[model samples]
Target: MAWAWLVSRAAALGSGASGLAGRVWKIGADDPRRAVHGLKVGLALALVSVFYYTRPLYDGVGGAAMWAVMTVVVVFEYTVGGCVYKGFNRATATVSAGAVALGVHWIASKSGDRFEPVIRSGSLFLLAAAATFSRFIPTVKARFDYGVTIFILTYSLVAVSGYRVDALLAMAQQRISTVAIGISICLAVCVLICPVWAGQELHRLTARNMDKLAGAVEACVEGYFAEEE
Candidate 1:
């Protein structure tokens, strides 16, 4: 069963890499190393969450905290950064997110939970600072927009949802650990297999790009010679 799970995950990773490689080439004029960095960032974030949440965080507090933090992160990414509400007053999204946070805080307060606003407040501050810095820092923008967004928005949502339900509803630590381990193994396998497929796709795209470059160079040369003539 373990071996099967490992193999399955590895296959998924390889498939994902193959899909990713094609998409990367299609996006036009992006740095290959940067794209790979984004991929690694996503994978690292996944591993971090698994390691952090799976062990538990002050019982229900940990889970609640995770949700609270997640809510903020999602709201910012989908709305502010994505500019989903661009024409419609950007503050609308920020205000809405604030309201949601307040409501959740109120609920937690009513439950007699100790107010631990620090985690969320600090997170928001950092998120804002990071967003602000992104304008000035190209790599930060690249890392967050490409690396973090890809994993958190795409991969982690489904993965975390399952982890949360299993951890809470069934209280199954062993089961969750097994799953995490399986995923890790699968990721490793994918790394090995993906390079072959991804390399071929990269080569094809690079050849195409080179062809365009050649045509542009020829055009420039012809124009220069014609001017001389």
Candidate 2:
């Protein structure tokens, strides 16, 4: 009987733990903010899909159009400011790097067709190595870190991939455009829909914490005096 009772208790405890674990996932699931975010995600996907399928808007871009949608997926944040910061970083990196890639391609092209591939490869390796070292610098990493990395890759594709295909400049341009479209979509949703701002929330939380700490100290002092009396 004791063994049976112990088993039953263990099973009850297991069930209780499982229920607690399940409830953890549901935290804030019913909150209006969560609902708004869900709606935004759905709407963004649907809207991008429309653009994805439309030939005129995405013509010649082919599957590359998905990169635009991918950017939106990765950059979208619950807060408007968060989304904007990330989107801006990505867009800046994409466009700035693309421009540099075009210039690099033009330079590398002058080195004869056979030598072009070798030059492009060497340049890619050097750029990647340089970008790695650059990213460790606090000041540079703050803004241009992503830009440096993307610049290397974009420069590589435009210069090296040219041997395999035509219109290297056009490909570079399309990629930049796709990234811009993605950033635009994310920013629009984050701002126009139930807008939230992380900076404001952070400030509010700091104030609440200060207020609570003050109240707790006051309560403790009152209790201490009461005990002395």
Candidate 3:
């Protein structure tokens, strides 16, 4: 009886696995574009991986090569517009935050040891608070919420780490460089291979809706004329 029960359980598991495979196949079959998007993403990742796989490139970035990978994963979107939007936000935020951090670090350093911690802490609190508050504004929230969030995060890390990390400038430069490399690869792939433009999609949708509305209006007018006749 126990042997029979075990066999039945194995059969059930096998059927479930087959069902899952079938569903996955159906999704790809229903929309070939999904498969194309997947391929594009894979290509972008492969291109970015060259930074780590090639000796010269790897040596240039050193351990920071992983930032390129992370940036690609985080910023890549299905549509070109989305990818560009996110990439621009990330790059701008990183640079701005890094600059501010460096400036603050310089100032704090010049203020002597006793006041350095106090200055750093005060700057952190004030900047973080202001960035957070900006999110509440409709215009800023709509267009730059992501950038602001990244700014807060990047600034906090640099400011906090500056306490112990003497080579803050080098560290920030490596990260920014890797991120830029990743963004460039992603944008290139998105634009060159199976390009999907969000603006085009929006245009198509708008035209379709306009056509439907026109047809509805024509039908209403025809009905009213026929009734008057």
Best lDDT goes to which candidate? Answer: 3
Model 3 has an lDDT value of 0.93
Which residue pairs clash in candidate 2? none
In terms of lDDT, the poorest run of 10 residues in model 1 is 78-87
Question: Model 1 misses residue 112 by how many Å?
Answer: 12
Candidate 2 lDDT over residue span 83-142, tens digit each: 876777777767766676666677767878888778777777877788789999998788
In model 3, the Cα lDDT at residue 10 comes to: 100
| Superposition-based RMSD of candidate 1 using all C-alpha atoms, in angstroms | 16.3
User: Compared to the true structure, candidate 1 yields what TM-score?
Assistant: 0.26
Worst 10 residues of 2 by lDDT: 23-32
lDDT tens readout by residue for model 1, 1-229: 9999999999999999999988868763464544553554355345445544655532433433343223323322211223222212222322333343444344433544244344334444564565455546766455344333322232223222432242322322332333333334334433442232454656889999999999999999999999999
After superposition, the stretches of candidate 1 with alpha carbons farther than 4 Å from their true spots are: 1-115, 118-136, 144-186, 192-200, 206-229
List runs of model 2 lying over 4 Å from the truth. 1-26, 29-31
**What's the best-to-worst order under lDDT?**
3, 2, 1
Which whole-number lDDT from 0 to 100 does residue 171 have in model 1?
Answer: 28
Order of the predicted models by TM-score, top scorer first: 3, 2, 1
